[model samples]
Target: MPTASSVIEIPVPADQVWQLVGGFNSLPDWLPLITKSEPGEGGRVRHLTTADGGVIVERLQTFDNVARTYSYTIEQSPFPVSAYLATLQVEALTESSAKVTWSGVFTPAAGTEDAAVEALFAGVYNGGLEALRANFPA
Candidate 1:
């Protein structure tokens, strides 16, 4: 399995950021890769496009309000991978700022290139965090 994590400090209050990221349905507004995320425990996330212009779907595994986190597993991926799990966590650093961490682990399918997969994951994770920072600049 390969894992990647990134954090960003946003000037927005923790509640503000949480309000945006806490809801799974808001992903399409901020995430460039995700086309839409339906609101439900077992809802599906539709990808806009794959590296090869294909589509992908992921199943929601957990969305914990108390923990301020959401996770999903790739059920229909265009990539050659399996057991994909991604999560997002939010923590308040101050009244006017907060830290958001996004992380995930996945196993590339047999014969798939690990480096390429890791790079792709890192790019998407970090890019998403950057997008959030831009949306809620500190």
Candidate 2:
């Protein structure tokens, strides 16, 4: 399994960040790569059209308001990945500051290189974090 993680501190209360990230339905609005999202357990996310017009589907595994975390896995992906798990967590750092952690693990499908997959996931995760910063800038 290959894992990637990124952390960003947002100058906002945890509740505010939670309200945004926790509302999984609105991911496409902030995350450019997501073309559409259906919010709920077992909900799905569709990737935006890429140059190759590839498609991917991820299933919501868990959404916990108390923990301020959400988890999902790729139900259908174009990449050569046999399994994947992704999660986002929000932690209160202070009254006006919060930390967001995004991480994931993916086992490449047969004949795929783990390093390439890890790098791809790292880029996607980092981009998502950057989007959040832009959405809730200090």
Candidate 3:
């Protein structure tokens, strides 16, 4: 499996960051790439509309509000990967700082190079984290 991960440190309380990101359907609140998120399957599935009019469907695999983390799998997406399992987590670096990490493991889609897919997700994760950090400007 190919894996990619990105972590960002934000000068915001972990709880505060979690309040914005912890929900399975909250991506649109902080991620500019996601224009809207609609909950389905009793809140376990999310149908996301991208800023560019693309659609991605993801399902909540695990959730831990107390831990400020959630893991999800892509049910449908334009990204070139399969078995895409990703986790987003927030941890306290200090009372006023947070360490947020997003990581994923996946199998490259047919005809897709491993390096290409890995770099693709790494870019997505890194870009998404940067956008997230912007919400809590230092």
Candidate 4:
């Protein structure tokens, strides 16, 4: 399995950032890569459409409001990955700052290059966090 991670510091309180990101289907609101996230399974599942027209289905595995974290597994996607598990966490750094970490582990799909797959996901995560930070500036 290959793992990729990205950490970003947001100039906002953790609770505030969590309010923006903690929802299982909130990706489209802040993530630049996702064009839309249609709700399903009573909001526990999201059918996400990427900006480049890729479709991905994901199921919320765990949601912890108090901990400001969530975990999800990709159920279906065009991406070259299998057994994808990803987590997003926000930690309070100060009264007006927070650290956000997004990470995932997955096995490279058949006929896919591991380095390419990892780089793609890392770019997605990093780009999303950068968009979030830009959305909420200090």
Top-lDDT candidate index? 3
Error of 4 at 19 (Å): 0.9
Q: TM-score of each candidate? A: 0.84, 0.86, 0.97, 0.96
- Go through the candidates in order and give each one's C-alpha lDDT: 0.77, 0.79, 0.95, 0.93
lDDT of 2 by residue, 1-138 (tens): 788888989999988888888865667667777766544444455333433456666677788889899998877777777668889999999998899999998788778788888888888889888988898755
Instruction: Give one clash count per candidate, in the order shown.
Output: 0, 1, 0, 0
Q: Candidate 2: TM-score?
A: 0.86
Model 4 regions lying over 4 Å from their true place: none
Clashes of 3: 0
Model 3: CA > 4 A from native: none
Q: Model 4, range 1-138, lDDT digits (tens) per residue?
A: 999999999888999999899888888889988999999989899999989999999999998899999999999998888999999999999999999999999999889999999999999898889998987966
Output the TM-score of candidate 4: 0.96
lDDT computed for candidate 1: 0.77
Model 1 lDDT per residue over 1-138, tens place: 788778888887877888888876677677776764554444455444443456666666788887788888877767778888988988889898889999889998899788888888888789999987777744
Per-residue accuracy of model 3 over 1-138 as CA lDDT, tens digit each: 989999999998999999999989999999989999999999999999999999999999999999999999999999988899999999999999999999999999899899999999899899999999999877
